[model samples]
Target: MSVRSLSATLALSAALVGVGVPTASARPATYELSGDAGGSKFEGIGYDARTQRYYVSETTGGEIHRGQLRSAAATEWLPGDGTDGRWTARGVTVDSRGRVYVAGGPNGIDHPGAPDLWVYDRDGRLLAALRTGVPNAFLNDLVIGPDGAAYVTNSNAPQVFRVAQEHGRWTIRTWADATATIATQTGFNLGGIVLSPDRRALVVPQGNVGKLWRFALSTGTVSAVDTGAADLVNADGLVQDGHRLWVVRNFSRVLTTLQLSSDGRTARLASATPTDPDRVLTTAKLAQGRLLLVDSKFDEPTAVPPYQVITMTPPRR
Candidate 1:
């Protein structure tokens, strides 16, 4: 292998070593991404377990970066030419077949196009750009269901967009529209989302209320997940592992862990751990037992080398 490829392989091997091991005994470590020092506005994160590579999406620049675990060097893997000045990249998820689906916006009043779901191949080639016809659609985070359907959340509107293959072509439309009780948003509603263990429902947190909600897949029903006295408060990116929920509170700089009841209607606080407080972390992905986070720092002036992904062991509940 070439020198650069060899280095990446070594780093990935080290990262994979901790995948199956329990995080309760693992120590936290931070790996800085080195390459493309431009203003990326990195926000969303996704991990491809098959290749042991993590994908980070840019919010404003519309670029996708690929890096190995435990490595400081990351290459500019996908430069979505259309994303540069017009569309913006938000959340991203990679399917079992290595197909990458990216979320974008109904932003730039002058841009004049609905939000879209951009799909790409493993090589970063643009495969399809599926648009959500919803007006002012701020397509935020997304999750791929067991049946190969994509469920994406819209922070601006009280709805979820679903993309599926029909007649050999992809189609996008509103899957669920939240009713009055659960579709609340102070600034950004429904930031991060994940599917339930059984893949029958989606668990999401309201950014404004800091409360969690469950949306049934079989039925277009929405209900709040009782947290008793605790609130996810500012919940952003979320990942579900069995009965445990891992959430990122961006503004608070903390990762909150919760244990869900058997029926998936209630949750209770397990633990909350501190992350890099100075930087704003938007989303997280689980690689084996390790959790990887991307630093968006959206409002801050762009840094020289920009920010890096923070990898650590999830706090014990």
Candidate 2:
């Protein structure tokens, strides 16, 4: 890393955060956020239903930072603890028991699994390590199912796989993989993955095309969910709340809300309202009807502002 990058990361190391509860509304609204100073670049994020806290990953290095969202732009971040100040924390999720599962190895593209996953408890204590089941494990993100299975996003093989608890450890298999619906549409990077409330469908953000893809487990087929998905609005991260589907599009820099079809066949805009968009996206259930979002791309290293996580209140439920 360059001096600029090293110095930026150190800044993040010394930064202090607080833990507090944020207020909510009938329907969620989006809240824009303050930008990151040096490094603080993020890869994945998740919401912890049990604690109402948000977990974010810093791909710049190890460190899946935890934040207590007290309100829009108001957050408390945990300190990085490990060799270089914590493991390489990326893509995040919280199990029903509230244990956090994070992709912590193979920091960038083309990198394969070297024990790519890590598990932590409510206090950020390391609990266990999970190897990205794939050979060239470039895990982008992950989601936990009702059965407690971990569905991880693999950016390399370009497919998602299921991780089950076995032999007293997390194991991966093709049971779900064989059941996935392949996208007829090609030429896009697949990142972020989330399941519908019904757990019958898996939704992913096709990073290159700026759209969301819904994978039907029962049918074994994939297709675009939004008419605007193939269009170049720059969709990045994803998450679902109740019947609401939320999307974050960069370039246009807007956060959109949609109503999901019961069958997971379609999603449509829920409100005329939209929030300022950024390079990164992810959703979390904070308080009952509220959500917390992080925008890692405030300014680009080349294009605009340095990356940072933002807070957003989705349209009121």
Candidate 3:
């Protein structure tokens, strides 16, 4: 279906479901992204609350698109066609200082001279791009740690990389390795990451196995999270507000909600909500009091344009 027709259908569906259309003065319910000729598919999203701008990554070619809370469309911020040695990009996050960190998924696995991640300043200037020096490393998603460093998840292995500027230079090092605790799987292992409510540990989901693990910030110890009987398979992006956590299962088309404990060791399944049936919602970020989800279009054999980022009301705890 064409973009216009698809949009109209979505509007009708929303209206039928009791979601009224936004007025002209209100923020747009959907933000359109520029299309790529060779079937562009998006995955990750990052929001800069300070600047009111959000970034989306194109998996087909590592291009980055930027949009604002007031705008209805996003423009390509960075070219992806092998620019800066990045052929494909995945997760993104903006730190307090406005530095943008992008995870290059499998970009450096077998390719020589490709970076595993890239860091850009607020003004879109390249700051650093370095490889994680791990074979078959698939850096999927990342989150800024409490110490202002980027903690990236590796899907190919049970490892988290610490990217930071120490002394005066930038460096990438293995911050935590849970090979003994978390076994390697055929598909993506550790996908989405978020900090606990108390900010003492990192909550990471093993997507392939539908399991959650807590990585201690102080000691880097890994422990299994007790998610009793909650099927969180294909969990992609995660958003946390207080003790409530929203897990976006991309292929499953369901948003699983969980209430975490103070220390982030255990979780109780609160609710499971199904998303839109048409779009495969991947990573999401909370901006302007709404949840902006990336309609990755991964389920499509050849993605149909124009691509989009959809908005929805966040689930209340």
- Name the candidate that leads on lDDT: 3
Which 10 successive residues of model 1 have the least lDDT summed? Answer: 17-26
Q: How high is the lDDT of residue 123 in model 1?
A: 89
TM-score of 3: 0.93
- Output candidate 2 Cα RMSD: 8.6
Q: Which ten-residue region of model 2 has the weakest summed lDDT?
A: 16-25
Q: TM-score: which candidate is best? A: 3
RMSD of each: 6.4, 8.6, 2.5
Clash counts for all predictions: 0, 30, 0
**Global local distance difference test of model 2:** 0.56
Where's the lowest-lDDT run of ten residues in candidate 3? 16-25
Provide the lDDT at 73 for model 1: 53
Off by over 4 Å in 3: 1-25
Candidate 2 error regions (>4 Å): 1-38, 71-87, 108-113, 174-188, 218-233, 271-274, 277-286, 302-309
Considering lDDT, where higher is better, how would the candidates rank from best to worst? 3, 1, 2
Model 3: per-residue lDDT, tens digit, 35-97?
Answer: 697688999999999999999999998999999998989999999879999999999999999
lDDT per residue (tens digit) for residues 166-238 in model 1: 7878888899998576655568887888887667888878877788888888886988888887757789999
In candidate 2, what are the lDDT values of residues 1-317, reduced to their tens digit? Answer: 22443453345335512111123343323332222345455556777766666677765545555654444332425444343234456678888888887765364332343456667777766666556455655666788866677777765544676777777775655433422344423433566777876788788776665666677766636676764432324555665777776665544545556677765667766542334322344433334555455555435563234334443445632
